[model samples]
Target: MEYGYYPGCSLIGSAHRLNSTTKKIFKRFGHDLKEIPDWHCCGAFEYGNKNELTDFSKSNLKKAHGFCNDIVAPCPACYKNLKEANQDDGGSFSILHPLDVFEYFDIVESIDIKHDLEGRLFTPYYGCVLLRPKETAIKNKDIMENFITRFGGDVDGEKVKDRCCGGNQFFINRWATEKLSRLIIDNTHGDLVVFCPLCHMALKTFSENRKVIYFNDLLLYVMGETDKL
Candidate 1:
């Protein structure tokens, strides 16, 4: 499968690990992630209302329209933006999460990461999108736990998986974000694992003593393609 990837701002800088690990894992699965050339920020936080006119919003929509293929994203913010971009541009292309792509191959037994999470404790945190009503079809939370199981890792299934970590909003809204992060971190028995780079960053910032990782990072670790940092 091929997808037009959007590596949003954060992944290019603080979240570079997401891009590297994502490319490695997707390539291992025989999926091509072609990036859209000259792509810019999708306005990270929120988009203006329809009546409001702005080049950032228009450019974002236009770039998404130009892709004309399935859009895949590793960042939760990127996923939210890409999908919203398509909607803003009249649903020009199908937007898919990399997790969906991973599930597709796993269900067919086409690709398997050579690793396990058994006996290792970690919490899988899904930002707003995973908990929202729209992603119900992907079976987001349960499937994530299942993926951990595939790698022989003991995922603490009892932890709260859908809490908001405030993400980049942490700097802007420290109190709310910190409160949310503390609730999840304290409730989770050990470290945390996440699909979104922003969530990974937020969790790491929230608790330095605790370990936090991206899902793709775990895949690379199990594949023996890289060593623990």
Candidate 2:
């Protein structure tokens, strides 16, 4: 089952670790990610106009659709934008988040756990783009819980799980982003597992002595692929 992949610009730039770790962890799960050729930005949160965003998202979707009907977007912004594009175009294809892949194919149980993180609490943060606007959200919001429990971890299940991390305003207003990040930090406890690169940056920049790790990197850590994360 080969799926077209869109790594988005962030993954290759500041979030390079996410790109490498996503590939490494997914390969370990016996799946493959064929990156979309001539891929462009999904417009991300840059252009909010409905028409502008649709065009930006559709460009990548069309390219990936040439490769496969099911496209996997590792970045949350890419996932949301791609999902919205598919919907606007008569729902012609599938847009799957990386976490969605783990659950949809039912692959989590198949991976052997190399280490048990007993009593280590983990907070699953979806940020704004990943699970808002219900129509574009992932099918199973609770899908991440299984991995944590199975891998021997505690989940905080914070009510602010879907709160906005103010990524859209990061450049325009640093104070606003910090305020949002502080709100999330005040509500949730334990290490953070974020799917979006911007969320990681927002939380890491404002958090005090807290581990804000990318979801893929955390998977790599629990799998014993690295000596220290």
Candidate 3:
């Protein structure tokens, strides 16, 4: 199976680990992820301006569609923007997150789980961008929880899964971002917190007690490819 891959801006910067691990796991699953040629940023959160956001998103979508109809982004922010752009443009192309692509291909059932996390506790953090507006959000939260369990990690139910991480306000208002991050950390009752790149970044900064990791990192560990990550 093959799909158009959009790394987005974060992948090269804060989310480089996610970029490398996702490619490694995809290949192990017998899937090919050809990067969309000349892809641009997904414009993160739009703030209060829609025109500039639409223009930036549309431009990136145009490049992605030029490569393939199915484009998968690893970052939730990128996925949301790409999905919204595709919908607004009435394009036939499909925009999906890396998790969605994995689910579509049913990669979990075939996983070997070389390194099970049986004794560990994990909190699946959704942050904000991943599940907002309903339409673009990940439809099956259980799939992620099940993935954790399949790899031998116990999903903690006490953690607030859909809390906002204040990623958009991180630069604008440090206080708000820290406040939200604290709320998530305070509520979490796990040894480790697993989530997307943005959430991982925010939560890790404010969290001193628990380890925070991207879900891709955990998946790589399960595949026994942690050395590469």
Candidate 4:
């Protein structure tokens, strides 16, 4: 299936790893992540200028509809914005997070046997944007846990799953944000597997021992894309 792929500002900029790895995994599974033409940023959580986030998202949503009804957003913030646009603008389209796309397509059955995670710990860190407000959250909230179990990783991320990572406030007061992020990180000694790049950044910035990784990077490791993993 060729779905409209929207790479929000973070993905194209600091979160490129998530974008690249997400596209690679989908491509490996034979699903096309067709980027929507002339797509604008999701505008993150900033608002006030209703037109900036809403109008821009609706604009992208319209173009994505022209591409296809199914839209794949790697970033949770982008997914929420796009989904909101579809609903608020009366567009008939399914906005799916990459994790939802994984559930939609049985890529696990298609790929060859890959290296197992071998009991590695994957903290399914949702941060904040992925599963809040109920409206934009994906249908399968257990997706991260399910995927981790599918690859032999232990489910140890729940302790800090719902904890806030101080988000963009990390830049405002570095010490306080670090305190918040460290509390979340210190709870789990294993790597933090997150869907949002902002979450990834917050946890990683203060983490000392534990490696923070995007869900897509974990997929790449088990898929043999790189031996480094």
Candidate 5:
């Protein structure tokens, strides 16, 4: 019923829609998401490059455990990082994505019945770090596909769909990312739908009909039509 919410840096800052829509859906599920007090950024992906993995995990684990054992992260980067921390520290806490929270409560009130993506042709985009550490139980591609299907969307299975979106990689090697992005677009051959902000930003430049959207935005659009919380 209650969990410690971690909005991450992107969602709290650039992704305003994510934070607002998340809170709205939480309320609909009768769940309280109290933000971790004095929370710090999860240091999305690149943090471990500088700091020791164990040390970074310890620092974040302290901040998270101080709040609660049930940690819910809205951003894929944050979710992967927090989950990694919990495992590395040998902590008992369980980290879950916000969508998992929504699904757990069976809260459909926040989504509009008519706005479902039943017949839409959409491709999932998983940026770097979404399913990190390479050993976690969660797979970004699978999770996003499950979430899409729950909301009524057809996932393209013609070929391998669980590939990177060439997002952060673009920052360093534009050529590699361009090649990757082109392959991804060519494979999907339609509009791409994704949850990661970085992925959305990257694909926007290459994909002409780029329809990058936060999964939370879709929920918000549906929620707007429902009775206010």
Candidate 6:
């Protein structure tokens, strides 16, 4: 399977690990993630609220349209913004999340686990952008849980997985964002919290003692591709 990939701004910086692991895993699973040319930020989380007419996301979709009709974004905020742009422009391209592509290829069933997690507890956090507004939501709970179990990790079903990490407010009000991160960290029952890049940053920032890792990083560790990210 092949699709145009949009890494967004975070992928090159805070989420670099996610970018590397995602590309590696996709190649290992016989999928190609070709990056879109002239791709820019998808207006991320704050851009949408700041200006509705500018539509920075349209520039990305327009560039992606030159390459392919389908685009996959690893970041939830990017995925949402791109989807919104496609909708507004009435473009033929389909915006997809990474989980959507994984499901399309049935990635979990196709790969063999070289290492097991030894039943370590993990809590999955689906930040706001991934699940809000219903239409753009990826609905990846079952797939994520199945992936964790296949790697021998037990998904903590008790934790509220859909809570927001207060990513947007992180810059506006640091104290409130830290409080929200604390709430998530305090309630999680696991050896480490597994989530997308933004949530990983929030959880990691507020809780110095707790372990927070990206889902792809955890998968890479389970695959024995690297030692403890």
For model 1, what is the error of residue 4's alpha carbon versus the real structure, in angstroms, after optimal superposition? 1.1
For model 4, give the 10-residue run with minimal summed lDDT. 105-114
Clashing pairs in 2: none
Note each model's CA RMSD in angstroms. 2.9, 1.5, 2.0, 1.7, 3.7, 2.0
Better of 4 and 5 by TM-score: 4
What Cα-based lDDT does every candidate model obtain?
A: 0.70, 0.83, 0.78, 0.81, 0.67, 0.77
> What TM-score number comes out for model 5?
0.79
Q: 1 or 2: which has the higher lDDT?
A: 2
**lDDT accuracy of residue 175 in candidate 5:** 80
Report RMSD for candidate 6. 2.0
Would you list the rank order by lDDT, best first? 2, 4, 3, 6, 1, 5
The residue-by-residue lDDT of candidate 1 on 55-140, one tens digit each, is: 45347556756564777777766676666656666776777777877776664254344554557876777767655647322344
lDDT of 5 by residue, 1-229 (tens): 8888888788878777778877877776678898877667777767546355445545766876657779878777778777777777785787887756655554553444646666776666655555554755343346556656777777763353556767778789888778877777777744575667677767776777646666665565445644321
Distance from true location, Cα of 183 in model 3, Å: 1.2
Per-residue lDDT of candidate 2, residues 37-79 (tens digit) = 9988888877758898889888887787658888888888888
Which 10 residues in a row give candidate 3 its minimum summed lDDT?
187-196
Supply the global lDDT for candidate 1.
0.70
What stretches of model 4 exceed 4 Å from their correct place? none
Q: How many residue pairs clash in each candidate?
A: 10, 0, 1, 0, 0, 0
Better of 3 and 5 by lDDT: 3
